[model samples]
Target: MRPNKRDELVSKALNVFYRSGFHATGMDTLVKETGISKTSIYKHFRTKDDLIIAVLRLRDENFRSWLFSRMAALSDAPAGQLLAMFTALGEWFGKPEFAGCMFIKASAEFQNRAHPVYQQSTEHKQMLLEHFTGLAKAAGASDPAGLARQLLTLKEGAIVLAAMSVTPDPAGDARYTARMLLQPYLAGG
Candidate 1:
């Protein structure tokens, strides 16, 4: 099926923003990549900043849904679900075209605390934390909040390593480390 115009724009914009920093991406690039006119693009997205916010929102929703679906497919046991989360992240990191975390990238570009994109990135992180916390609780974790925080730290650390030029397999290493750290919790579960 043909993709809708909004999806097309989003897909193109994601690539542009992912390859080039968000600050470097321009409407013209999105227009050329999507084969949509400037008017149509603006009609859907009032401004470049508006489009960026939309893209970030779309990215957050897409990532959350993808992670949740993977977790759901695993056994109802919390241990299994937690392990699956690590595996899923490893798989994403292993993708040939995998770039560093989009939220992290955007946040780095827009360091201002008041920046809308930066705030969206913070919200995205919080959402992930909540998701993990819920999973930890379901798994009968003794300290669900703590476990979630640790997992978030591990994930963010891995993203940083992956972004670095020296760390090959940063994602895989991070997954391994996370699994080791969470092994006790899973065993308790």
Candidate 2:
């Protein structure tokens, strides 16, 4: 089925944003990439920032769905799922088009805390941290919040390292570290 103009614009905008970033990708470029007229684009989104926010929202939904589904497929145990999350990251890193975290990039570019893009990016990251915190709690961590923070650090660090290099498997390293940190929380430890 053919996508509506709005969906098509958002889909194309996401690709362009992923490749050229929100700040760098111009409206003219979006017009060319999406093959949508400026008037039409403006009709759907009042401004480029609005379109960027839409793109970020799309990314947040898609990324979370992928990660959660991937983690679910790996294991049922909370501790196992926490450790296995890196396996999902590894799969993402292995993708040829991997270009680091979009939310991270957005937050970096949209520095103002009150900015919508920045807020969306912050929310995306916060969601990930909370998700990890939930897993830590379910896994019976002695200090669930601390473990969540530690695990989130490992996860984000791995993302940065993986994005920087094409060789070394940062996800594998993160998984190992997560396992070590989660040891006490696991049933046998």
Candidate 3:
């Protein structure tokens, strides 16, 4: 089924926000980029923040779906799937449109913890943590929570570095570090 106007607007706005950032992309910019009139956008969203929240939700769904599916496709075992996440990141970083994590950008622009946009950003990361924790448990890590947190740190750090161009291949660097971290849990490290 084709997406409705609201969904279409949100989808277009997501690309705009991803490229230009939350604060940097104004309503006018959104209108121009998304090709959705201000009146129509307001019909679906009460405010810019509301539209931002919707866009973040769409981003979270798309990102997690892509990352998880890529991981699964790369490996059959739970532990291998965990490692394959870095491989997926490598591919994403290579994309011409790559612009780092949108959640990170949103939280940075909306710094107040109580802000809805910030909370939404936090929720996205928490959901990711939950997924990592589940994978760690399934992989039989003695301390699943600990492993998950470490992996999340590595993942976030890799994203930052990749976005900054601080290193030629942060994903490869992350995968190397992840191997060391997961060595104990792997069949033979």
Sort the predicted structures by lDDT, highest score first: 3, 2, 1
Cα lDDT of model 2 by residue, 39-83, tens digit: 999999998999999999999999998998899899888988888
Worst 10 residues of 3 by lDDT: 180-189
Every candidate's CA RMSD:
2.3, 1.6, 1.3
Scored by TM-score, the top model is 3
Better of 2 and 3 by lDDT: 3
Which candidate number maximizes lDDT? 3
lDDT of 3: 0.92
Candidate 1 lDDT score at position 141: 81
- Which of 1 and 2 is the better model by TM-score? 2
Candidate 3 lDDT by residue in tens digits, 1-189: 756999999999999989988888899989988888999999999999899899999999999999999999998777788889999999999999999999898999999999989999989999999998998999999999999999999999999999999999999999999998888777655
Tell me how far the alpha carbon of residue 64 in candidate 1 is from the true structure, in angstroms, after superposition: 1.3
lDDT of 1 by residue, 13-114 (tens): 877888777878777776777688999888888889888888899889988899778877865677577667766776777777778789999898989999
Least well predicted 10-residue stretch by lDDT in candidate 2: 180-189
Task: Give the distance in Å from residue 20's predicted Cα in candidate 2 to where it truly belongs.
Answer: 0.9
Q: What is the TM-score of each candidate against the true structure?
A: 0.88, 0.94, 0.96
- Model 3 residue runs over 4 Å out of place are 1-3
